[model samples]
Target chain A: MDIVIYGTVNSIVFALIAVGFTLVYGVSRIPNFAHGSIYVLVGFLTWSFVNDLRMNYALAILLSLTIAAVVGFIMYRFILIRLRGMATSEIIASFAVSLVILEGLRMQGIGGFKGFIGPFYVLRPFIEGKMNIWGVFVDFQRLIIIGGGIAVVGLLWLFTHHTKMGLSLRAIAQDERAAMMLGVNSDRTAMISLSIGSALAGLAAVIILPLGSVTAEAGYKVLIYALAVSIIGGLGSWAGAVLASFVIGFAMKISTAMFGAVWESVVLVGTIILILLFKPSGLLGKQKELEERV
Target chain B: MSMLEVSSLMVFYENALAINNVDLRCQKGEITGVFGANSAGKSTLMYTISGIILDIEKKERMRGGERVTVLGSIYYEGADIIFMETSDRAKKGIILCPERRRIFPESSVLENLKIGGILATRAQAKKTLDYVFTMFSPLKGLKKREGGFLSGGEQQMLAIGRALMAQPKLLLLDEPLLGLSPMMEEILVRAIEDINETTGITILISEQYARPILPIIHHGYVLENGVSVLEGTSQELMDNPDVKSAYFGI
Candidate 1:
């Protein structure tokens, strides 16, 4: 039961990361490989500001979010906008940006070194208390992470369903040309979606940093897991991302416990391949040919 | 005075002139129908006027070195609008119900309408939504239906309905009656007339078949091989032997 709870908590955190990937791809029709870099950069920046400069945790998170949002906006304006209508070029450009960011972090002396901070010290005592059920001890941190993840997902679902901007984004995702004809500014909408997505990734980074020491190289691994989640979830769907994250998370944990850590990635890759073979669109993906029908 | 004026306008695609020194005008509250063959630049004219085709980026060269100018000027309510973006032009009441009935296919009918009303204030959007529903009563019943599932005729109605939601002063209809049953075509013609009569909105409709559109338009232009060879009132064009031979199959 404790193992189950741990898997559930880790699944939720990974789901948050996958949601950002799905959101940007859904609206912009770009894979956005640099998204994982943004996530890692934010975590490093937050660590630097809070642990090194002795800033408040709340202030550090806010500053990190702002920085991510600004970088996202500039990237869209200068790079992504020019790459629009060129899918291959856009994917290549995103990959290049990811490499640049990763190397930049290393050159700046923030890569491959595990850095730890205890900003959640106040909540530590409460979280340290264990709840035993069915001969299993569950920690409070897992509960908090699980609850927070669910809350974030719920809030995003509500916003996308109930808000005007959210509806606009969905409309663009469905048919960008039609959305533009209806007076939706594609550039502005893309910028807002990218900003929101980057901020969500940043928030997830902050939440996960306290659970383990963060390093720049951590992002690539997390990104691989997130991509697997995204593929299993359906590339452009929020609900699919969440569901896939849980499935992969649980599978990975179980596989790691039974076999070893090395088998976890192998299991994930195999599942994704099977999913693609059976249902190429992913679990929650809308019908691709429906657009051609109209 | 004309609501929109184009003089010596030239359009090209990779060194090939699609519209050559075309001159046209649309009067207020008048339906100006453009008649042309498939590649005679009818759609190109509409796209240029709507500012969809970027003249600068898509340019090769103009015949007279004018560099593919959209001369002399386009005016809406007597205001110069040559420099406005497509979205700004939409906000200023110039709307395009483009060919293919480009509705947001995955969105519900109501959501599609809301997208069209993006430029309006919240209160105004609500009012426009109500107005659109009234204009197309069938849309009110199918407000929750995804646009992709709608029939061709229904999608056409939704497209026109969406444009109405924008409260357009000048509406550009590119092939409004294309690919419709005879009954559907009649209904569309009547609906367009009703819109013009009630709202006093000016409309420019381009059509290959002049039979159905000639009776509805106030004036018409006949484009042949990328040039405006004929221009007159609808009745005059209907009687022209050249028009009869080229378009009407008389």
Candidate 2:
């Protein structure tokens, strides 16, 4: 019962982190390498708003997510727009932007040698309560993550299927040129994709960050985890990303329970390598490059 | 005014001319056929008219690959629209049903039609969608089917229906009958005729086979090696022995 409950929570967290990256890749074929930095930036932004400015938690969360969306929009419109269609340049440019944002925040740390942020830099959870179910106890935040994550995925599916703009975005994902012929503007679609992707990253940050303290280094760890799930599931495959999250989520939780905390990363990295060696396209991926050569 | 006019249009991919000083016109409420064999620039001309060539040229240049040059003048509704962006061109009622029926593979038939209806107002989309269903009845039962799994003829029908959903004043059908059986070809030809006659939407259809398309087209241009070798009405082309043997497999 414990493994089932915690493993589900782990899987939800992983899916939330990876969904943003997979979406941008699916629509525009550009891996937004700045995903983790955006994730951490939102955590920090909300933290400062709530702690330093002494704002309401709900207000701060709203402000941080909106800012993240705008930041994503600007990143695509100004920088990534010119670099479109060149995957290598896109990766490099996003990585550079991410590094600058993260390192710039670190430099804002209190003094010279010591960083400004420490484990003490944390955001209070929204509910501020705990729940127990069937002989296992978990916080309200964990329950929200589980429930909220599934809701997000379901809502996204409905949006893409039933809404005009969402349908256009999916059209752009499938065939950019065809969409263009049908009057779907590529630039506008890509910009919107970036905006939504950024907001999603921020949303995940807000939901998951309360479980742990915010740190500059956490950005790197988040990026690695997101990338690991994406690669293991198959890049740009949405359903694959969700399903792979569950796989890795359970694996990591079981490993931690069996060996120790140190074995978690080892298992994560090991799973990625094994997947790459055997099925590089991932479990649910139908990416163009991974199309069978024969 | 003609629905579309092209004059002195030439396209080049690094000195290899794909289209050479070609001029074509599709009258309002008429069907025009451009018949050509492989590498005869049928697809290129279609792309150029739909303004997709501009995009292709830009992408190639950005990637430091082939340098594409397009020299052309296209007049629509008595105005020069030679250098417009593709989506803008589409918004102006010039929609292209691309070669190989480039349907969105992952989307279902209904979703694909909705995407194609991006340019229209809600009412127009609804009207056009209903009209499409009536015209291509095969698509009615396959609303939930993904495009990737559709047969070639079914995809062609979906492609045409999708373009119609955009509420086009002029539709460019590129290789609509490609890889279809004889019966499928007949169905599409009749459907294309019906669409043009009933709706009065100007159509510019390109095909490799002249036999199936020749009778329906009011005007036809026979292209060879990127050059228009013969231009005549249907009856005149039927009387031309060279065209009969070359294109009609006489």
Candidate 3:
């Protein structure tokens, strides 16, 4: 009962972290390395607004997410647009942006601004209480993560499947030239994708950061967790990302419960290696099938 | 005035001329065919006119792959569109049904058509959707199937149907009858003639094997080694000894 409840919560958390990363990759073919930095930035920004500026908590969240989205738009328009097609440069450039944002947050004593360094920054949960489910004690924050995860996925599906804007994005994702031939602008779609992706990262941070304190160090960890889920699931495969999240979530939780907490990272890395050795494409990754067929 | 006019068009990929000094025109509400074998620049001419070559040139330049150069003026609806972006050109109703049927493989047939309708108004999209269904009746039954799974003929139909959803004013069909059975080719040729007759959309079609589309074209140009070697009405092209021996398999 404990494994089932905690495992599900853990999987939803992974989904929340990686969905943004996967979405950006899916649409723009950009592995947004700054995803984690944006997540952490939102957390710290929200904390600063609420604690330092004495703003209302809900208002702070809205501001932080908006800033995060704007950051994404600027990142694509100014910096990344010049280096669009070259994959290695994209990775290096985005990772450089990630380093600047993450390290800049940890900078000390600049212009009377103390850096966001320690575990003092934490977001208050929407509701504070514990609920018993099948003899397992799960907090309201975890419940919120589950609900948020389902909502995000469902809304995204509807957006891509039903709406005109979303259909344009998907058209660009599937075949860029074909989409352009049909009048869908690739650059515009890619720009929209980056903004939506960053907003999603901000949303995840606001929901998940409430469970524990927000720290600059958590940025790197969140990035690695997101990478792990994407790699195990297959890069750019949304359904694969969700399934791989459950796999890693259960593996980590079961290992921590039985063997010890030390085995958690070991299991995560081991699973990635095993999947790479056997099925390198990830379980549900079919990105290249269409190309080969054509 | 012609609906589309290309004059002195020359395209070079790293000084290897793909299209050289080719001038063509598509009169409004007439089917214009450019017939050539492979490497005769049929696709390049189509790409140049639709402004897809600009995109290809940009991608090649970005990747440091090939240096593509285009020197020409493409006048569409009385405006010089030589430097216009492909999507902008598409918005102006210069839609291309690309060679080999580049449908969105993962999307359902209906979704592919809907994506093609991104630039269309709701009423326009609705009317065109019904028109596409009626014209390509096979697509109506395969609405939910993914495009990649369709057979070659069905894929070609979907590609043409998908292009029609964009409400093209000057439809460019690049080798529309490539790799299909005789029956399928006959159906598409009839469909192309029907579309041109009923909708009055000016069509610019390119084909290597000219026998199938020759009967439907109002005027035709024969290309050889990146140059427009001969041009006349369909009757003249059919009567030309060189064309009959080379393209008509006489």
Candidate 4:
């Protein structure tokens, strides 16, 4: 009972972190290596605005998310655009940006005198309490994480289905040249994708950071978690990412329960390797059947 | 005035000329057909007119793969539009229905239509969708079917309908009859006529098989080895001995 409850919560948290990466990769075929940095950056920015500046919490969240989205837009416009078709260069450039931001936040005096490092960078949760679910005592933050994660996924589906901009993004993801023929500009679509992806990261950070103290190093950990889930589910498939999150979440939790806490990372790496070996396309990668038929 | 005019247009892929100095014109509210055998630059000509060649050129340049060069100009509605972006050109109502029926394989038929209708107003989309369903009733039954699962003929119908959803003034159909049955070809040819006659959208069709297309097109250009060797009215091409032996297969 405890395993199921905790596992579901862990899975939702993973989905939140990975949804941004999945979205960007799906639309533009860019891995968005700066995703984690944007997450941590927004986390610290929201923290500073709420704590140091003593601004309204909701307003600070809105401002920080907007800034994160703009940063993503700038990243694409300035850096990623040059290396658009080169896969290796895209990975390198985005990773460099991530490293710069993460390390910069580690230094003293940007958001605080001591910077965004150490245990001092904790964020207060929206609500501080506990609730019993399935005979397991879980905090309100975990509940919010689960609820918010599902909401985000559902809203994303509706956006892609009903809205013109979102449909254009979907079209670009499917066939860029074909979409362009129908008046969908790939560059503009990619720009919007980056902004939405970054904003999603900011949203994930805001919700998830409250459960633990925010740290610069957490960026790498978040990136790995996002990659792991995306790979396990299948890169660029939304449903795949969510399902893989649940699978890995439970696998990691069950391993921890049986073996020890040290086995968490071991399970993550092991599951990734196993999935790659068996299903190289990550269970839903582009559906090769279509190519085979052609 | 012509809806689209291309004069002395040449495209080279890394020194290999794909389209050797070609001049083509599609008058307003007419179906202009460009017929050729494979490798005759029919697709290249359509791409160049629809501005897809620019995208190809950019991609090739970025990848350091092929060097694509385009010379001369294309005029649409009396304005020089040789270098317009493909999407901007599409916004100006020049939509390409693309080769291979490049439908989104994972997306459903309805979703594919919705995606193609991105540039249209809500009312235009609604009206076009109804018209598409009325014309291609097979699509209505396959609304929930994934695009890849559809047969070649059904995919072609969907491709044409999807293009129509964009409300194009000039519709470029590239090899729409490829890999389809004779019956399916007849249905599509009839639909093409209906679209041009009813909606009055100008069409530029490129095909290797000129049998069905020649009778329907008002004006036709026969391309051989990247060059326009013979061009005249449909009846003139039918009477031309060279076109008769090569394309008519008569």
Candidate 5:
């Protein structure tokens, strides 16, 4: 039961990280490999602010989100915009940016080191007690993670579905040139989407900080898992990503329990390949229609 | 007064000239037709006038007298607006219904129309949408359907309806009758004429087929290899010996 709750919490948090990656790719049609770097950078920045500078946890979290948003905006304006018509170059650029960011952090004495910043006081009480349900003892921390994940997902859905900006985004994602011709500003839309996605990732990172120590390279595993979930769910569909996340999260947990942590990634990778082979359009992706549109 | 004036307009692809020393004019409330064979630079001229092909890199190669051109310069209740972004140009009553019926395929027909009316206020958009629905009543049932699912004729109607929602002073229709059956072509031609008659919007249509379009247009130009070889009233062009031998193949 404990393992099950842990798996659920891990999956939800990981899904949020994946959502950011998926949203940017969906709208821009560029595989943003640098997204993983952004996640790790935010985690490290939050840690440095709270532990190194001894700042308040709230203030650190705020600063972390702000930094992530600014960086995302800058990357879009400087890097992505220049490579707009060249998609392959844009993907390569993102990969290059990820390397620069990761290496820069390492050179600055922030890499190859594990740092645990805070068992944030506000969240400490949640993990203090455990509840027994159906012969399984569920930690309050795990419950909070799961509940918070659902709330965030619901809010994201509302924003994407109900808002005018969200509607514009969907239109742009469908046909960028047509959207531009229709007066939808692609740059502003992309910037806003990237910021929102990165902020959500920052929030998830802050939430998960208490569960484990964070390293400079801590985001790679989560990145891989999230990408796998996204591909399995469908490239641009939010509903697919969420459902895939749960499947991946649970599957990983069960596999880890049965096998070991070493073989867990292999199983996840195999499952993704199988899904891709069978359902190339993904679970929720519109197969024939969108391809023709593109 | 002429609504648009172009003189000695030259366009190039890489190093080769595509449109060489092209000059043309369109008067207010007139439907001008540009007839050309494949690769005759008709589309290139339209793209150049619409500012889709910028002179950023090609400025050095451009050379001609009276090269200065004015687009959307006609006084519409006292306003000059030739230099505007495509969307801004659209808002100020200069809309282009591009070739291939460039509809937002993934979007619903209603959404596509709404996007076309993006520059207008919400109430204005609503009113314009209603006007579009009235103009293309066949589109009323397909409002919720995605643009990709619509038949070619329906998509063409939706494309024209979308341009109408912009409330244009001049609408550019690039090959509206392309890829349509004879019946569909007739329907589209009638729709185009009806829109012009009812709204008083000036139109410039580019086409490869001259027979169907010549009857509807007031003036026409025969373009061969990017240069205008013949310019006359539609009836004169239709009756001209050279036009008959070269274009009409009659």
Candidate 6:
């Protein structure tokens, strides 16, 4: 019961972290490397608003998410737009942006603001209580993560499948020229994607960061976790991402329960290596052979 | 005045001329056909008129790949829109049913049409959806089916239906009958005629085999190696010895 409950919570956590990354890549073919920085930025922004500015907690989160979205729009419009098609340059440029944002947060003497360098910044949980499920004690925040993950996935499905803008986004994803022929503007869709992706990263941060402290190092760790889920699930494959999250989540949990906590990272890395060696495209990923056959 | 007028149009991909100094016109509410063999620049001409070439050109430039150059004047409804963005052109009612039926393979047929209706008003989309079903009844049954799984003929039907969803004023069909059976070809030819007659939409259709298409077009142009070698009415093209021998398999 404990394993099942905690494993689900862990999987949901991974899914939340990687969903934003997968969305941006799937829609616009852009690997937004600043995803992690955006996550950390939102956490810090919300913290600063609530603690430093003494604003309402809910209002602070809303403002933080909005800022995250604006950041994404600016990142794509100003920086990534120039380096659209070149894959290597895209990665390098987005990574550079991530470095600037993450490192800048820790830099001293920026507008008389002290650097966010400690493990003291933490988001208060939405509801501070524990619930018993099948004899397993699970916190409300973890339950909220599971609910939020499901809601995000469901809402995204509806958006892509039903709404006009969402349908255009999918159309562009499949074939940009074809979409354009039908009047779907590629640049607009890409900008919308980046904005939504950044906001999602911020949403994940606020939902998950409540469980732990917000640190600059957490940004890198979140990015690695997101990347691990993406790669193991096959990059840009949503169903594959969710599946890989569960796979990694359970593997880490089982290993920790059996051997020790030290085996957690080992299991995560080992699973990624095995997936790369065997099915590099992922279990549910769209295969090149299938694309050619179609 | 013609719905679209192209004058001295030239397209080059790194010094290889794909379309060379070709001029063509599509009269309003009339069917215009361009007949050519493989590599005769039919698709290139379609891309240029629909402004898809600009996108290809931009992408090529971005990748440091081929240097695509286009020199021409395209007057659509008396406005020079040579350098208009493809999507903007689409918004102005220039929609291209691309070659190979580039339907959203992952999307259902209904979703595919809905996506094509992005620029349409709500009522227009609803009416067109009904009209598409009436025109291509096979698509009605396959509304929930994934586009990739449909047969080539159905895909072509869905492609045209999808284009209609966009409410195109001047429709461009690039090799719409590329790999279909004779029966499917006939069905599409009839459907094209039907769309032109019912909606009064100007159509510029390109095909390698002119047998099924030549009968429907009011005016026809025979392209040979990137140049418009001959231009005439359907009867004129069919009666000409050269067009008869080369295109009609005489």
TM-score for the A-chain in each candidate structure? 0.88, 0.95, 0.96, 0.96, 0.86, 0.97
Task: Please report, as a residue range, the 10-residue window in candidate 6 chain B with the lowest summed lDDT.
Answer: B241-250
Model 3: colliding residue pairs: none
DockQ (C-alpha) of model 4?
Answer: 0.91
Compose the digit string of candidate 4's lDDT tens values, residues A228-256: 88888888999999999998999999999
With a 3 Å backbone cut-off (N, CA, C), the pairs that clash in candidate 6 are: none
Clashing pairs in 2: A109-A116, A110-A116
Measured against the true two-chain complex, the DockQ scores of the candidates, in the order shown, are: 0.34, 0.87, 0.87, 0.91, 0.25, 0.89
List native contact recovery per candidate, as a fraction of 1.
0.33, 0.87, 0.83, 0.92, 0.27, 0.85
Local accuracy of candidate 3 as per-residue lDDT tens digits, A1-294: 898888888999999999989889889999899999999999999998999899999999999999999999999999889989889999899889999999999888889777776567778999999998888888999999999999988898899899999999889888899899999888889999999999999999999999999888788898899889988888888889999999999998999999999999999999899987877877677875344457
Best by DockQ: 4
TM-scores across all candidates?
0.88, 0.97, 0.98, 0.98, 0.81, 0.98
Q: What would the per-residue lDDT of candidate 1 be over residues A86-124, giving only the tens digit for each residue? A: 668777887788778776766733555534333332111
Candidate 5: stretches off by over 4 Å: A1-11, A48-60, A106-164, A237-239, A279-294, B54-94, B166-169, B242-250
Model 6 residue B203 distance off true place after TM-score fit, in angstroms: 0.5
lDDT of 1 at B98: 87
Candidate 2 scores a C-alpha RMSD against the true structure in Å of 2.0
Clash number for candidate 4: 0
Candidate 6 per-residue lDDT over residues A1-294, each given as its tens digit: 788888888998898999889889888889888999999999999999999999999999999999999999999999999988888898899999999999999988868886686679989999999998888888999999999999988898898888899999899888888899999989999999999999999999999999999988888898899899988887878888899999999999988899999999999999999988887677677744386468
lDDT of each: 0.78, 0.91, 0.92, 0.92, 0.74, 0.92
Better of 1 and 3 by TM-score: 3
Candidate 6 displacement at residue B51 in angstroms: 1.4
